[model samples]
Target: MGLAERRKVMGYSQERFAAVVGVDRTTVGRWDRGETTPEAIHRPKMAEALQLGLAELDALLTPPPADFPECTASPPCDRHGSEGIDDMIRREFLRIMVVAGSLTTLAPDDADAIAEAVDRGSAEDFRLMNGHLWQVYQLARSKSSVNTVVKDQLGALNEALKESSRAGGLYEVAGDLFQLSGELSFDGNRYTDAAASYALAAEASSHARAYDLWACALVRHAYVDVYERRYTEAAETLDVARRVAKRGNSALSTRYWVASVQAEVYAGLQDLGACEKALGEAQRVADLATPVHPGGWLRFDGSRLAEERGARYVQLGRLDLAEETLRRALETKTLSRGQSFRRRGAVLVDLAAVGAKRHDAEQVVTYGGEALRLAKKTGSGYIARRLQALQGDLRTCRRNRRVVELNAEINAL
Candidate 1:
């Protein structure tokens, strides 16, 4: 059965389910009528609220004409797994050194060390190291771990990109590196850096003729602009990404991911109509059930519906809805083990944000503290900025000493 049917079967009334899921009853109704669909991040929550397993929920969410050319054959996994362990480890160490330097305002030599490490690492190793660095950058920025280190990592990423010209055998590897670079910059609240990396990734994707990668890269780049309140720029980026995704097999998971992100951008702009349009498009692209596509890294099917949808609502100032949707999203299986800590921290921040909006100081203090604790574990700029934003919300709790302390702690970060 479809989402609405599933909810109904679970004995959830439209209003009740909307409350439980943190969305308007109308939005819930839209899902039932097939007029709208949840974003990928929200799928886990929807599955939980409806009491379905991931596999079954995914099947229900799949769009029709359920086959695509890409699904006709499996993409080869020819890239060697751990083909460059030594390089990866060395580069990782250097990246750590660079981040340490950046935070402590240490001498430029440490930053240089990170660059040298990247220069020596293999493409796969660099990519792997880049992933870890991205997380480190986020955590460090949130906790003010070390500016020098963060800068050093950024420098290392840049050096790696420069060394690896966007070409054959190295193009995908380089693209992955560039994407991670953008993610790091974005998480670090360095919008300009994020934009530059994403642009480079898009170029590499074009060279490799990988539409999904190109689209996802650009979409992420747009996210920084969206956060900066540059809605026009964000929308423009997504417009290009959407077109690029269409050029490939839209049924591919990345295409839907693009749609989901675009939906959030639309919501951020307060363009509810456009938001729904993108959401519908995402749902349509996600209809395919074929599992023949490649499935490591960058494999985002419409699997986290509640989180994505709820996040958009949160952006739209629909706090009541945001709470329900975000809470429901929390029910989804935690994101990948390595990544769950950061993602869950973000959701907690969102949940705390809703509480802050409601002037619920106790809830804010409770959730915000947990979020801060979790944020300390990762080096994500996104989480840092989120905590930063909530500082203003805590002003209402001036009378609440604990709330005042929480705000101070977050500010300290």
Candidate 2:
């Protein structure tokens, strides 16, 4: 029997059932209509309310569709011919984009193929494709321009959840995609949207039993609080995230990431001792030889610790420590090689802020100028925001011609 039928057999009205399950009536309605499934946290409560065992509840919640086909061929049979498949995928992509409130032009054929793979390809194929999309998003000059494609892919992933036989894998992928959506929103300064996405990602990851993914979602959520200067709230969130990460795979860098972000939050709170302790914990990630980062979703490999430490020191008003650490960060191969413009730009801006604090016009002009160029070239609002923060310190050197010119350039941005 289906969920609705089973609920009726148990003599519970939808309203009473929702009350028992601790959810809204519409959530129960959505479950009955197959619009959404019960989250993992709700499943046990639902089963107890319906007088069903865990396995029986799962079966009722996810009944196999009557028309699902069995593939007898050596290779999986394509229900839609190859040519028809492309057209169908394109239409689906466009429809999803419209539904997502985006009016983007069609993505190229390669991107279309990636979207199609999310629907019909193997689990590994989905992982690889999603990773590639993330790499593209990171390296792209215009981060906001990548949002449309990310939204489209998210739509495709939601559709895939409906028909996918591999429930665990699909849920994990959904978690990753939702986190990516949160990142895009965060980059655009949409804190509310970003928080919602991160919450959904945590739910999806819980359903998939992906411990690391769930912890990562919580960390991202804490970032929204951190950005708004709610240090205590962010610290509370990070405390939970740290616990969750501890339960994740030891081979993964999840716990270390939690430590890293916790350090940032501690710095925001101006607790230098707590910040230093957290940074020490985060540094252990560098020793882990095999960090598991599936699809590049959890890419914290301790490579950014120097810059992160520097930024934290800057926030704590330790200019002497900040300068030394930030200068070390700038000399790191990653920044010196020019492989990541965003990373290099952020470090440069921090150094300029240090110079501005000391009322050193030449040092401020030198570093701030390059950072501005990178912000313009990369269309990185993250860099632009950092530069704006630095601008407040530049007021001390307003009489200097170079400082005035730099301020004008930043104002133009």
lDDT (C-alpha, whole model) for all candidates: 0.65, 0.78
Candidate 2: which pairs clash? none
**What C-alpha lDDT, on a 0 to 100 scale, does residue 321 get in candidate 2?**
96
TM-score of each: 0.59, 0.69
Least lDDT summed over 10 consecutive residues: which range in candidate 1?
109-118
Best by lDDT: 2
Could you tell me the lDDT of residue 285 within candidate 1? 45
Off by over 4 Å in 2: 1-123, 164-167
